[model samples]
Target chain A: MSAYEKYLRNNRLPHILCSGCGHGIIMGAITRAIEKADLDQDRTVVVSGIGCSSRLPGYMDFDTLHTTHGRALGFATGVKFAKPELNVIVIMGDGDALAIGGNHFIHACRRNINITTIILNNNVYGMTSGQFSPMTPQGHFATTAPYGNVDRNFDICELSRAAGATYVARGSAYHAVMLTDLITKAIFNPGFSVVEAISQCPTYYGRKNKQGTAVDMLNAQKENCVTVAASAKITSDQMQGKIIIGELHKSEAPEYTAVYRNIVDSLQAKEMK
Target chain B: MSPTIKLLQGNEACVEGALAAGIQFYGGYPITPSTEIAELLAEKMPRVGSAFIQMEDEIAAMAAVIGASLTGAKSMTATSGPGFSLKQENLGYAIYTEIPCVIVNVMRGGPSTGLPTSPSQSDVMQARWGTHGDHPVIALCPSSVEETFWLTIRAFNLAEKYRTAVILLLDEVVGHMRERIEIPDHVDNVLTRKKPSVGREGYRPYQPDADLIPPMASFGEGYRYHVTGLTHDETGFPTNDTEKAGILIDRLHKKIDNNLDDIVEIETQMMEDAEIMVVAYGSTARSASRAVKDARALGIKAGLFRPITIWPFPANELKQYLPQLKQVIVAEMNLGQLILEVERNVAGKAPVHGVLRGDGELITPTQILARIKEVQ
Candidate 1:
């Protein structure tokens, strides 16, 4: 059997990242999901912004677009609408997805175009020397937030669900098997789907906060995450400190492009009759 | 030369022109005074294997047109007033990224949602600078339906040639009127995209070479490339280097500026020894044409200088005629926007007379005739 990992740019392997970089893990899941779903590799387009995670496009064999900062999802929306035959994937860092491009993020979900957005939440910015991100939890110190973060973190699955995304799921790189399944399901979904992967950023986030090592960070994610059903049974007081990981939402209204096509067809048919 | 006859309203000829231009992809949400262009394109584009989509809103319509053009299709979207305002962000995007697409604004009167079904040539300046930032633009305005056909063809041609967003400024009177238009049979002579010689291997999308226009390889073409709105070098990497950023911006200006003479196309009617020249564009200029003839009959040395291409402003050519003239009457459906450009170009060489209108209607021939007589 041919190894599905053949689609990766193996020459760029043993990534240039330091230990516990979340990008490597998130990218592994996305490319593997594309392969597992048997998507047309040529017909896949990956767009990314100007974060460490954005480099995921350059490492893939697909028709990748490395766009400006915060605009990866915008370009991905265009790519998907342009050719509905193509499986469009947008990989974004937390800052690229929720901070600089927060407006576009919600709107793309609101429009519900057929795009699979994989948001890599590492809590701190890695490329710009570890700045704090919107997803950085309280008391997480970074270059920008030296005195510990006081800002509330964004739950990406909740944001995606609220913004009308048809499919919303969360997984951690620590749960490698589950990540593959979540990403695979997202890729096969017909409408807008968001897979938020809580991966490790030991070099910046962990080192600054003294979270031992990459392995420790991974263990933290595995230990902190509880089932959504289990969390629902618990009170808000119990859910305050723990993270919930599972599919949060899935339903269908018409995707934007298909609805557009239908409008044109119906207009023409009415004119003919 | 084939016989040129005037028998079409400004909008009908625009339809014929868009059809002649091989615009196979049209996605628009209809707003008035430009709805006929969308209606006509919807009806006619499909007859020729084109796809017409009435999108969810003007934003998606504008966005989809750019997407379609990137996929190697000549595409356009049309709107007026409120819809035009909604289109500027994506329009700004097109200007910044140098995407080749056409936008037709059959202008109507308003600052905000004023008169939807009425005619007004108010969007002339918006066509030039509607989108934000310091970017080059090519906005073509046609006075008649025939010029609409010709200019729409040129809008497509210039868009393909220069890689910029070209606007077709129309007014209500021109769009809904029917007339005879001889559509062009073939437009293969118009430039298609320049394919990357680097092929699919190691292709950088925004890396324009010496000519400053990079070849585009489509998405499914196996050529992985990047297009962004950031300041970047030839490798398409986002850069913070000041000198490199300046060069990239300068190249954007140079691509349009260095080729302005080919870009600025105008038609002068009897400017050899005319004492008064009435300069106008869009349907407002059609009124000026009759007024000039009426003034000539009144024994005034009045002539018409109408720009088929409103942008690249035809500044130098208009300046050439400005010095010898006593009065240059500028008339439009808007209060005063293009008049500013005219006055700047004239630069105290002559008094630039302004005849303004903003009542959701075309400036009547009589309105322009009074201006010609008053200016003379």
Candidate 2:
């Protein structure tokens, strides 16, 4: 068994994710990241909104909150603010983060609160049995978009960076080791950090679009993905069909809870005087 | 000794009540009438060494309170009609997960933001059945500034005790109206949630006690349990088993229903030998009270039955007055919401009449008195 196995709730295993689903691999990456970050398991909380990816927290050993659809960031903000010492990690799917939760996602990034958010962007709502999502590729087939998706997709890392997240990165489940490293850095970041894990929903997204079997979906991720450094040297046309992975952006900003603590300290000091 | 008396609006009193109840966290957005609760708490919470946050929206506010509550803090949020509508989804989440928190909805006129500053008891039905699915709710409506303060505290107590979201239902009339109240320095009867009695290894987070309420353990306490909105067994993990789901839903309702004696609160004035009984709540209850007094002096036996706990509807208690009354008149600021409950409780035992006013105005004492006279 892997060292991160202890972090998982073994009894809750035989998880509901479909066979060969990337969500399980992403969950493994999260546990390894938490372990590598040296976070206090007792003081750590995993919060998630509704989705197949959101179910990741339910099988974790940490105190987990499987909240309403598309509101995990808002809940994480409260948990972090309530106990600033606790490690707050939020998990969501593309739809959970970008569709109904779009406003909260942007606001959470803007606040720069101390939280590590991992969005498993599979481009479809798998738990709803294959609805096209905000992150779904244009012209991709989904149950809801039988004639192919007409809506534009969100570039999650770019959105997070623009919304003021101190650290923003994108990685695919096909490269689990690299994704784990990004997640570890995000957990260590002092302000809001986001990791968009481009996962494959072979059961729903792959089947709907006739994107071949589970292995084919995995192979597609590998073939399309390009390292950030490799992407920089490529022309726009060369990078058109490529998925850029690895650290997209990082910056230094005062974390929200830390700033709030300063205000609290100053107010307390004034009261004493 | 006389209590220190100060004049305060109903909203201001809610702040004091929450503070006195040791509420350590408040997450709310600025919505009309209810905004004062957040504003006052913002200035006051930090002074008391508690935390107050202005969330992005009402949905976040409710979500935040639930999150804070799981960490063992007495958490609360305040919002109005449109905001309350936004909070329903999360409120249902809190219900299914059985996380204790308080939500204050200072209702304004609304189908959709019809009147922002005006008063309406239009949300009375929404408070009872706003969130989808079969779940229990405890909503307390205050008729005055003093009642607002005490009921706010009671709301928190009920939330903590039941491990469920409790709604402190207020209206613009009660929330903004200033009245003299003797602010008690301390309340001796304030209750906090009962913590876990067993150690981490021995604890089952959702397993209920004899009273159907589980002793809650805070997040950092080492009992790492999965809390979810999905139907789950005692283990707190999502279960697809129909048998386990049935038991979970049944227990959720039974917890509150079985404990209705401690939850439901109703006050009756001059109910004996009365031919006409006025059923009212919140701000409109004040009018009913005045009208009852005037009718008594005019030699008509009129009485008032005010339900402070509006969700359970006080149906059992309302039945007691069926024998002494020829008429049951429900006077509210909305177009006959609470009257439906009264009609159900009365069950054709008496002639049930509704005196409703939906013009974003209080149901006047004159209207109630006229109804009482006509019924008599």
Candidate 3:
């Protein structure tokens, strides 16, 4: 048996998801990361919000929390606090993370929670069938945006950096190798870390937004992407709205759990009499 | 002597109460009135290898508390007003999942961050129906700081004993008050959590053998079980079967409602021959208790009936108090929240008078006294 099978739920098979859907690919990447990290299968927790991406944990063999819309971060906060040593990972789509859960996402970054957030950014709401999202590109067409989206889109990588994510990166499902490496770095980071994977959504988002074939979308990502470090050194004219890929930000800060553990000493000293 | 008596604030007593309850984990963000609890627990919980983690927000704080409790630790979180508003969803999750945890709301002001450092009990209605579902909840309100510690311990005990979400309701006044409280040792406190009888082999996650309270098979203990907020089956899988759904709903209430006798908590002062009684809870009860004593001294028959268990609302016991009562004045910081329940219970036999203040400050004994005189 593959290392990934141990983390998969046995009862349910043949999930009701479309073919070539990137959720399965991302789940595969996550399980592989867990295997590579040698994380204890039991102690690892997977939490997700309401979306096609949210069902990933339910299909997993480990302890999972399938929570309300955009509330996965809140629930994961609980999981981490309950057992700081536990490896907690939150998996949700762009709509779930960058929109309804936008407040929590930014705050989680600021709090510097020791968890991994893998955002499957397809730029369109797949579960609810293509509603414009915070990450949806400008002029992107959706059911809700008939005349094309007029609102300026948010760059998730830039947002994560601004929100104080200790480790921030963007990888494309188009480049599976780079995506895996970025996800691994995020999982290994000690503080709030986010890896936004540009995933494919051929079923709804692709067919509607004119991204055409899944392969075409993959090529588009590859052509439009630039390394974060490369773009940082260059001016806006050289960038010209290119998707900055690779590790965007990486730094260290005192994590919440460690700082919290210090309170015991303070209280003990106070009561020494 | 037992202990030197002191006139402490209700909020201060709550801090002391949680100290006595043997709190090990406190994860809460600071909000009005309730901030004192996080303040006190942050100081006290760390003494005995315990911890107080100030989470990102109330949502994270409550989540952390719920998470900590699963590790077989006594955990709690404190909040009030808007912070309390943020905790409702997780509170419901705790209820449906039957996670043993304690939450304290030092209620002050408003439907929406109305008042912070002041007093309002509007959360009374929210505490019962705030979370968006039909599930049982065990809430306790303390009238004084003394009861604060006692009830705080009871909050943990009842949470463990019943395996349900327990609320410790304190007004700003009660939560911040400091009284000389004599807290008994660990051996003397009431603590509970059922151990698995099958020795982990025949352990079903939601299967309750006899008492309807299932043993907590903690995480990482080799006893794997799934827990969710959706309508789930005995095996903890999301299911839509009507019979299974019915059973799940029935057990949620049965765990607490059927055991209401054990869960029901109250404080009654001088009800023997009182013509007019005051019904209240939380810090307001302290004000009412004093009014009852003073009213009796002035030759007005007065008694105080306070509900310690606010959710399963002491329905039967409260119904008995309805008859032969000329008037029952329900004084609360919120604009007539708990009074609505009193009115429903008393039905019109004894005019249920409501004295309310929603501007985010507590109703004092003096204010309640004036209201009682006017009603008389």
Candidate 1 C-alpha lDDT tens digits along A218-245: 8888888877788889888887779888
DockQ of each: 0.27, 0.77, 0.44
Please tell me which predicted candidate would have the highest lDDT against the true structure. Answer: 2
lDDT digits (tens) for residues A8-29 of candidate 3: 8778666666787877777777
lDDT of 3 by residue, B1-376 (tens): 2554556666656666666666667788978776666776666666777766776678767776776676666778888878878999888888888888888888777777676767667788888888997878788887666777678778889998888889887777767666666544442656868867675458777888688887887665656566777888777767879999999889888878788888897778998777788998877787899998888878888889889888888878777765657888998876678888888888888888887887766678888787778777
Q: What shift in Å separates residue B29 of candidate 1 from its native position after superposition?
A: 3.6
Off by over 4 Å in 3: A213-245, A262-273, B1-9, B185-187, B195-202, B294-300, B359-376
lDDT of 2 by residue, A57-89 (tens): 988999999998999988888888888888999
Q: Which ten residues in a row have the lowest lDDT in candidate 1 chain B?
A: B182-191
Clashing pairs in 1: B10-B174, B11-B174, B11-B175
Q: Report the error of model 1 at residue B296, Å.
A: 0.7
Clash totals for all candidate models: 3, 0, 19
Ranked by DockQ, the better of candidates 1 and 3 is 3
Model 2's TM-score against the true structure: 0.98
Model 2 pairs in collision? none
Cα lDDT tens digits for candidate 2, B108-167 = 998898899999999988988999998888999999999999999999899998999999
B250-365 per-residue lDDT for model 1 (tens digits): 88889888888888889887788888989888777778888888888899998888887788888888877765799888888888988998889888988888889788766778
Error of 2 at B345 (Å): 1.0
